[model samples]
Target: MSQLILHHYPRSPFSEKVRTLLGFKGLRWTSVIIPAIMPKPDVIALTGGYRKTPLLQIGADIYCDTALIADVLERLAPTPTLYPAESAGLARIQAQWADSTLFWTAIAYSFQPAGLQSIFGNLPPEHLKAFMADRAAFRANAPRMRVPEAIGALRLYLEQLEAQLADDRPWLLGKATSLADFSVYHPLWYIRQAAGVAGILESYPHLTAWMERVQALGHGTSEKMESGEAVALAASSTPVSTEGEAFLDLHGLARGERVTVAATDYGVDPVEGALVLSRPNELAVRRVDARAGEVVVHFPRLGFQVQKVE
Candidate 1:
């Protein structure tokens, strides 16, 4: 098997989730740090136009979105299972809520004045301006929750988590950690990174203690690899064959059709390719670039849309 390559930067919350998961799985991976904002040329080479951070690459297969990435990681390393057999359904449901609702509320709250200052204080003014412009463009089509509203929602969510942890189980679902714990940990980790807002966790002692337990997981063993090296690796490899899985054909689109797959929410840019694999819950499109050669870009069907190209 080829080395696991993760394209991410340190500050990304979703990346942190995957990193911790890697630690929990006890896997060694290659790190390819990408820019915090746009103009991610190397990433574009691998993913076409889907420029979200923290892509997982194995051979010529690229997995977009943390949700799909988590699935792929679990498939690669099954033990210390992310989706325990007993609570798989419940764990997935909770994970979805944490990744979407809790995540956005935390983002809104973390972008408050003091948090923003803490994030950009040492950076040059131009960098900050560029970051703001990049994010504004990223969120152009998405509805943003106001900070005040987000604060109230965040507090309510934290109180609920405190209650869940009140029994001292050491994990959200039970004694063993599951997908829900990691999904929920990243946003809180982001909030903790900001100087002024970290005190928000102090109010919930049990929740804070649980957060510490999750934080101790630490990112797994990683060796640095250049973006160019990662692209070259993809260029030289073939995507894993998806030959046996039955195609559900929800869109009346057949395999080998030219199509575009894109996230329905923020980061709405699409990737155009030949549809290679489609299941009820997942999609993969094969695209080729001069730098990255042939690669299969995969996305979760939950928050994304797939359309045949005209």
Candidate 2:
């Protein structure tokens, strides 16, 4: 297998989620630090405009969305399963909730005045403005939760998690950490990133302890590579050697057909190219970005739609 390449910037909470998972799995991966905002040429080269951070790349296969990225990593390294056999279903559902709901709440609550100041404290005003614009674009059409409401919900969720750990449970599940752990970890990691506002966790000792345990799992072995280098890697490499037999055919499309793939919400730029791989879980469009050259833009089937643009 080619090295697991991750395209991410340091401060992304979603990227943190995948990094901790990689550490837990003890996998070695290449790190490609992408721009934190728009004009992600190299990333667009591979993902066809699904500009979410922390995209996982294996060989030439690209996996978007942290939810799907988690599953892909689990498949790559299964020993310390993210999905435990006993309550895998429940764990996954809960993790999804934590990742989506709890995550947004924490962001809303933590990025309040002081938190935002702490985060962009030193960066130039223009950079901060650009960051805000980029994030605003990302959340453009999505409904936003009120700050107070988000804080209340997050507090309740944290309380529930605190109770879960009160029993001296080594993991969120029975004895070992699973998807629930990583799901819960990312948001708190974001809170921690807020520096000043992170003190909110002081009240939840158990949650803080769990955070330490997970954070200890440093992002699996990674070495930095330039964005151009990563692009060249993609251009020179052949597509992932998949059997291509597990395709589920959600769209009335076939491999090798020309199609367009884009995110359901943000970063709406559609990348049209030969639909190279439409496997059970993902869609890949082989397209050329003038800046990044030939690349395969990819996305998970969930939260993304595919069509044969006429």
Candidate 3:
């Protein structure tokens, strides 16, 4: 089997979520540090035009989105599961809310003036300006929450989360650790990057202890790998065939036809390829590139839209 390789930057909270999950599963992975913003040429060569951070590449299969990554990891390592059977549905719902709602609110609250200084204070002025410009364009489609509104919503959400820990439960859902815990924990984890913003969490003792528990899981064993080497590895291998598997048919595009898939919310760059796998859990597109050769890129079915290419 191809060894797990994670392409991510240190500061990305979603990457931290995957890292923590790797630690939880006790799985080793190869790390390929990626640029936080655009100019992700190596990533684009493999994923066509999808430029999200923290992609999981195994041989020629590139997995985008942490939601799908969690499922892939679960399949690889069954025990100590992120989704306990009884609460699996609820777990996914909670995780989705955390990844979207809670995440945006926490980002708004954490990127205030003081938090901004903590995160980008040392950057050269031009570099900082460039970063801001890139982000503004990236988020052009989504309306941002005002800092004041986000602060209020975050505190309210934290109150509810703190109450979940009232009976000394170790996780957010109930007895077992679920994807919900990791999803919620990551944004809070990002908040702690800035002391001024993280101070808000000090009020909740139970929440603080729980955050410590999550942090203690640590990133699993990893060795650094160059981005060039990862691309070359893809060039040397062929995408695994997904034949005779149960599939989804909501997309009207004919089988093997060229299509474009893209995130509906942001990072709207489209990836064009032949529809290779159209299953309930994932959407895979087979595309060939000069550098990465032929590779099948995968994205979670949720939050992504499929458009038939003319």
Best by lDDT: 1
Q: How many backbone clashes does candidate 1 have?
A: 0
lDDT of each: 0.92, 0.80, 0.91
Candidate 3 has a TM-score of: 0.98
Q: Is candidate 2 or candidate 3 better by lDDT?
A: 3
Comparing 2 and 3 on TM-score, the stronger one: 3
Q: Which stretches of candidate 3 lie over 4 Å from their true place?
A: none
Model 3 is weakest, by summed lDDT over 10 consecutive residues, at: 245-254
TM-score (C-alpha) between model 2 and the true structure: 0.92
What lDDT tens digits, residue by residue, belong to model 2 across residues 160-210? 889989998877886878888888899988998888777878898887888
Runs in model 1 deviating more than 4 A are: none
> For model 1, how does the per-residue alpha-carbon lDDT over 177-240 read when each residue is reduced to its tens digit?
8999999999999998777777888999999999889889888899999999999999999999
Candidates, ranked, TM-score = 1, 3, 2
Task: Write candidate 3's Cα lDDT for 33-124 as tens digits.
Answer: 98988888899999999987789999999999999999999999988999899889999999999999998998899889898888888899
In order of lDDT, best first, we have 1, 3, 2
Error of 3 at 277 (Å): 0.7
The C-alpha TM-scores of every prediction are 0.98, 0.92, 0.98
lDDT, model 1, position 50: 90
